[model samples]
Target: MRNKNSRNNREVMKRILGCIRPYWFLVLLSLLLAVITVVLTLYIPILTGQAVDLIVGKGDVNFTGLLAVIRNIAVAIAGTAVAQWFMNHINNKITYHIVQDLRTRTFHHLQVLPLSYIDAHPAGDLISRVITDIEQFSDGLLMGFTQLFTGVITIVGTILFMLSINLWITLVVVCLSPLSFFIAGFISKKTFTMFKKQSETRGELTGLTDEMLGNLKVVQAFGHQEKAQEEFEEINSRLAEYSLKATFFSSITNPATRFMYAAIYAGVTIAGCFTVIGGGLTIGQLTSFLSYTNQYTKPFNEITGVITELQNSLASAARVFQLLDEPALLKDVPGAPALENVQGKVSLNQVYFSYLPEVRLIEDFNLDVCPGQRIAIVGPTGCGKTTVINLLMRFYDVTGGSISVDGCDIREVTRESLRTNYGMVLQETWLKSGTIRENIAYGSPDASEEEIIQAAREAHAHSFIMRMPDGYDTVIGEDGGSLSQGQKQLLCIARVMLNLPPMLILDEATSSIDTMTEIRIQKAFAKMMKGRTSFIVAHRLSTIRESDVILVMKDGHIIEQGTHESLLEKGGFYAELYNSQFAPAG
Candidate 1:
């Protein structure tokens, strides 16, 4: 496990560096500034030592020479400050730009990922990876750019300056520095595992919170507040535990390195004092060597801190890269023709599918429909009713057999073209945070104002929309903020009404609307389905009575098929289902 983790860490770092490659020029500029800053900073200690030498005795001091040395020191300090500022500015630019690029690529990759991948992952977890994890990575990378380069340069510069003063003292400082590195490295190796666990727990907590919040009403109605709280607390406790462990390990690194460095500083001091007494070094030179010792050790402290942060960053980066590495949807057939002028005809020949390979949910399903047919599919819950729509929409391709439209296999056509010809509205309504007009025009972005209003009127939503303060232009929040469920469903219906695609799939689309509104919408649907291929999946038996063909499914098989009246006469699964819904109350 340790070796595997080390390998993954190396790979994550390589990819991060690859992201920085595009901004090499800015990174180069920052490095140059870091060098200048370190060099000028180290030069200041030399000038201070010279001023110390001029102060030979209280009254024997060379005031003019000391003043000149102090002036030079001030100039060096000012130069260091200027270089540090520009370096920081450049680092900020590079860090944020890399962050922006990573976010963009991650989001874009999401768009192409197969629906199966999305269905298997929680929205909250994916969101945490994209937003929270990337932000953590950003903080780490920024710290790295700001300190890593400067710390390295400072360490090297201080060593060179000390060696020039006295080789023996420099060797002592250098020899003792490895202790700090060993301590820091030992602590950091343990932090990565803890931090990774913390990140995972955080994502789980986010997923649970989002799931609860998104369905807070259901949770409250079911009196599940306590249960939900318990689940949340469990995940939250794990997150806290992991976070504490990770933080504890990383936090100790600074002080631990500081202790080792203190020993190195004392050793250097003792060694320098003997050299000064033996006349091997002047008092001013000894002072300068002590200053170099402090300088050399400071970078070790800072670099250790940087290493801790980088471990956290790499953990987050590993999660992010894991997302990016998911297999994208298979590319559309090259040079495939766009599905245009679609006839309403569609055929499914021996189609098979399952959410899990070991457990089949749909198998060997076959169906054929002529142009201008209204097909209503009905079954008990989990009877593969919605799964049929998924296959038809190509959200999940059939594992075997094939589905074709107008005698052309769906897989041979561009997905954009295939999907564009079908308009779908599910039981759950979704509305973006926008004006009612914009929401209605979502399916048809270029739809004219008149067309949008006409679609809303047809869906029986115009009256309620006009009652809002802004009427058609009334702005709403995500998922139709403050709107009634029926109102949101009406808006979704209006969207499809605007597009009027050649094929339509209504999966319990009117479940949320009142009976009165549904009756009127049914009339509109009748008109819309007049010349289009329509597939209606509904539990309300009465709603599908007008369908040309009614399919009753059981365990992924079509057990009965016919018009509602004919199916009722058969007294089969279809009759039993219809009677169960509309049978006289006992």
Candidate 2:
């Protein structure tokens, strides 16, 4: 398992390195500066060695010469700092561009992915992949890697310099480095486990937050505040524990690395003293060699940590790529055509559909309509009413048979074009946090002001909209909370009206509205459906009693279909349903 993890770590590092592949020249340039800095910085220690030799040899101590050496060392250090700063700046800029490129590509890829993929993934989980996961590349990969490379180079260069001074001592110091590296590697690997757990847990927390906010009304109505808070606290406590563990794991790296440095430094110092006392090395050379050792060991700790850092980075990148790599299950043929200027004549021929395999929801359903026809689907709860709309909209493709618009297979037309001549008002109206006008205009963004007002007026929303503080410009709170349920539904209706699709879908559009409001909406819908094909799904059967045709469904199959009056005469499911309502009316 350890070996497999290590191998995975190496592979991830390789993939992350690919992000920098396009900017290989920039990386090389930065490394050139870093190497130059390391080289110049090493010169200062060597200069110190010469000064030490001058003093130890009892040579005439020229104060001016000593001062000049000090100044030169200072100047060299300053230059090295500048070079290192430039390296960081350039690399950071390049990483930003790379991350930006990756984000753009990932988001674009998501746009083309099938609804199934999104359905399976929580929005927040997917969002974390795009935003949080990619952020790790910047946080852990780009900077971490460059430092690792620089450290390796500096360490290797310093070792060679030490070897030039004394090969035997150089070998001894080099031997200690493996121990330092191994300990650092081990610690970092542990840290990687903590990071993985923390990242996954954080994603779940975010998903939970998103899910709860989406159903805020249910939460409030059920008075789940204390329960929700308790649950959140429990998750938060778990997250806190994992986060602290990750922090501690990473925290050990620095102090442990410093301990390694201390050990190496002590050994080198003791070894140098013996060499000096035996006249095997000059004081200056030993001092300079010690400086090189410090430089070498400092970077060794950094380089050894690359495996752990790369593991986390690669895991993040892989998640992002996983999202991007998904194939769009819903796609038009290569030569797919536009739906064309449609007549709104829709047909479902032998439609069979299911949300899940075991739960068949629509079975061999058939429907046909001439242009400008009004049809309503009325059924008991879970009788596949919404599933019919799902089929019509091609939200999920049919498992059997096909739906057509104007006699052309919907599958053969581009989804965008096929959906252009259709409009929907869902039971749950989704309003953006925008002005009333903006929410309505979303249907036809290019609509003129006059058109917007006309649609709002048609839907009976203009009067209430005008009563708001800013009228059309009133900024809606989250999900249109500022407005009443009836007002929000009316706004959605106006939005659908603004689009003026020849075929319309009202999926319980007025189910949440009062009877008076429903009557007003029904009047507006009557006008809207006059010269267009429309399908209405409603539990309030009165909402569709005047429809040209009514279809009754049960357990995924249609049991009855005829004119409303004809169905009432037949005394089947539709008649029973109608009588159940009217029996209570009188």
Candidate 3:
């Protein structure tokens, strides 16, 4: 297990380094600055030691030499400060740019992922991975760049300076240094697993928070607040537990390394005193050696702290990479033709599909529709009503057989081309945070203001929109702030109305509107569907009564098909379903 984890960590590190490769010039510049800063910084200790030598006998001190050494020390300090500042600035630039690139790539990859992948994962969890996890990774990368680079360079520079003074003392410092590394390495290994668990739990907590907050109204209506709170608290407690354990392990690394370094410092001090007495080293040299000892050990303390943070960072990075590594939807077939001038002749033959491999949801489903037919699909809940529409839209490919649009297999056409030819209004309405006009013109960005108003008027939304403070220019929040569900649905309907495509799919498109408004929209839809191929999925049987062919489905198979009046005469599933909605109250 340890070996596997170490390998994973290395792989994550390699990928992180790959991201940094693009900004190599900045990274190289930062590194050059770090070296200069460390060199200038180490020079100050030598100057301080020289000043000590100049103060040979108090009254007989070389005041001029001491003054010159102080001036040089001041110059070195100023140079170090400047270099350090530039290094930090460059590190920040590199860290944020890499984060920006990662976020862009992750989001782009999300756009191409299959809908099945989306259906199986929680939106909150995916969101946490994209936003929160990447933020954590950025913090870690910045710390690594800012501290780790200097720390390593400082250790090496200090060692070289000490070696020029006394070999024995340098060896003692070097031998004891391994103890600190050993201690830090031991603790860091343990922290990695704990930190990984903490990150995963944090994502879970975020997911839970997002889910509960997004549907707070529903929770209250269903009286499930307490249960939801309990679930949240359970995940929160686990997150707290994991965080505590990880922090405990990581926190130990610093003090533990500090203790080992303190012992080395004491050892070096004692050895230096004997060497000075034996005339093996001058007092000035011993003083400089002690400073070098302090410098050498200081970085170990910081490096250990950085390692702890890096472990946490790698954990978050693993989650981010997991998202990026998900198998994206295959690219369009090479040389595939764009679906153009679509006449909306669609056919499904021996289609087989299932959300889960062991559970069959759709099997051997077949359908054929002429260019200008109105098809209504009615089914009990969970009977694959939406699945069929998904297949028609090519959101999910068939596991067996084929579906074609105008005799051209949908798989052979670019998805953008295929989707662009259809106007879809789902039961769930989504509106971006924008003006009403923008939302209405979403599908057709080039649509004129007059055309937008006409579409809204046809959808029976013009009156309500006109009453708003900004009228067509009123800006709305992400979920359509201060707007009723029916109003939001109207905006979505208006959006589709703005650009009535070659084919239409309305899955409970008017389900949220009032009966009066729905009646008006139905008249509008009648005009729009006059010569277009349309597929309507609805639970309200009355709405689809005029459909040329009504498909009654049960458990993934069509059990009945015909006009509503013809199905009512048969008194099968369709008649029973239709009758239940209009049946007299018991």
Candidate 4:
């Protein structure tokens, strides 16, 4: 269970390389400072070698010149340290901005993504990419970026100086370079798989957490708290195990690189001793070469670390790009115009649809509604009641047929225009964390304070809101947990009412509400429906007895259509369903 080694060629790398574009200047400046630092660092060893030679020759130490050289070398080394610090700070700024850009683009893209995309993906998996995957990419960038530049710069500069000083010793250190490379490549290849697993496990863990939080009530009701905890622990424990494996593989690089470094250092030390004894190279030069040899391997180790991270980061980058590349299969057509005030008339002509291409769910469905008509759609489960709302909302495109509102093919009109003119209250009510007034005014965010209260009054939510401690401003905790299900639905209804859209869709909005709440809401609903077109989907057929027209659906077809009394008189599907599910007030 390891990730495949991506042969993601230079082309893919070229695309993501734009992230480095904005930081080009910073990169150049860092490199310039790095060069100065490398030059000064190399000079220190040279100065020490000269100082040794001066002490050996002409005995008096050249007092004045020696002191000046000592001071200059010290200051140069200090300057190098300062420059390195500045380089690090600049790199941090550049990497932070890059991460910000990536994250910002991801969030913006998420907004444009169709609802179907979210429905298709697991919550935990998607969230993990945005949060965890991005974080990994950032860390990779920081390490990979800093090490790549500085590692090569320092190593090359150190080797050049060593070669100029004594080719024999330089060759000894250079020869060991390939060993570290091979080890790093092998270790990184092995470790990348573990890191990928860690990332996957993290996504699963986050998904479980989201699932538990979303269904906390059901879990608690079913007394599955311990079971959930166990499941979480099972997932968490696997994550921990994978993390440890990744860490273990990653740790191998340290010891492996250090060993390679030791071999190089020891070989150079032996070569230096030979030079000293044979007088082929001076004691001072040998000492300087020893210092140079030690510095060489440090960059290699840094490079190894960065290489490992680069592999992991590239993997994360690939995943992010995958999401960005996903086509919006459903979207507004070109040159679509926004609707101003939609007349409530709707028509579906020869419609055919299915989530799966080959398995058509609806075939040849056709219907028409006149302006301001109150229509009720009653059907058996899976008979397309929800699909009707879904199609009208344009959540998915119909394979065949066109839907029109006020004579404009909905596809020809912009999505915003179509949805803006409609107010939908779903069977399940969802409220964000906000005050009662805020929740009730969500559909019309710019509504006047008085307008919000008026809407709430019409929805029968104002009376209870007034009884709360903060009245209208009373906070409804997450998902309206602070209010009962019925109360939450009423707030949502108020929000819809506040919008005063010409068309309203109540798809089983009252199915979950208690009888008393339903009766009160129904009364308010009647007022809301006055002089406006409304489509209601109700399992309880008696609830729609007063509908202007009723359509009974079965197997995705409108099996019967007529007024409630006429349908009952005709004794068709509508009459049978109404009689079977509800017999009126007995």
Rank the candidate models, highest lDDT first. 1, 3, 4, 2
lDDT of 4 by residue, 450-489 (tens): 9998988888888888999999888878889768888888
Query: What is the clash count for each candidate, in the order shown?
Result: 0, 0, 0, 0
Question: Higher lDDT: candidate 1 or 3?
Answer: 1
Query: Tens-digit lDDT track for model 2 on 284-303?
Result: 89998998888988786666
Model 1: clashing residue pairs?
none
Regions of candidate 1 where Cα sits further than 4 Å from its true position:
none
Task: Encode model 3's per-residue lDDT on 1-586: one tens digit a residue.
Answer: 9999999999999999999999999999999999999999999888888888889676879988888899999899999999999999999999999999999999999999999898888888899889988998999999999999999999999999999999988998898788888889999999999989998888888888888888889999999999998998899899898899999999888888888888888999999999999999888888899999988989888888889999999999999999999999989999999999999899999999998899998888999999989999999999999999998999999999999999999999999999999999999999999999999998889998899999999988999999999999999998898899999999999998899898999999989988988999899999889889999999998899899999999999988999989999999988888888899998
lDDT per model, in order?
Answer: 0.93, 0.83, 0.92, 0.84
Task: State the lDDT of candidate 1 residue by residue for 1-586, as single tens digits.
Answer: 8999899999999999999999999999999999999999999888888888899667889999988998898899999999999999999999999999999999999999999999899999999999999999999999999999999999999999998998887888888888888999999999999999999999999999999999999999999999999999999999999999999999999999999888888888888888888999888888888898899999999999999999999999999999999999999989999999998799999999899989888888999999989999999999899999999989999999999999999999999999999999899889999999999998788999999999999999999999999999899998999999999999999999998889999999999988998999999999988899999999998899899999999899898999988998989988888788887998
Between candidates 2 and 3, the one scoring higher on TM-score is: 3
What local lDDT does model 4 show for residue 142?
85
Worst 10-residue lDDT window for candidate 2 reads 303-312
Give candidate 2 regions above 4 Å deviation.
Answer: 1-11, 55-59, 304-311
TM-scores, all models, native as reference:
0.99, 0.93, 0.99, 0.93
After superposition, which runs of candidate 4 have C-alpha atoms over 4 Å from their true positions?
Answer: 1-4, 9-12, 54-63, 223-234, 329-331, 583-586
**Residue 33 deviation, candidate 3, in Å?**
0.8
By summed lDDT, the worst window of 10 consecutive residues in model 3 runs over 51-60
- Quick one: best lDDT, which candidate? 1
Candidate 3 segments exceeding 4 Å error: none
- The TM-score that candidate 1 achieves is 0.99
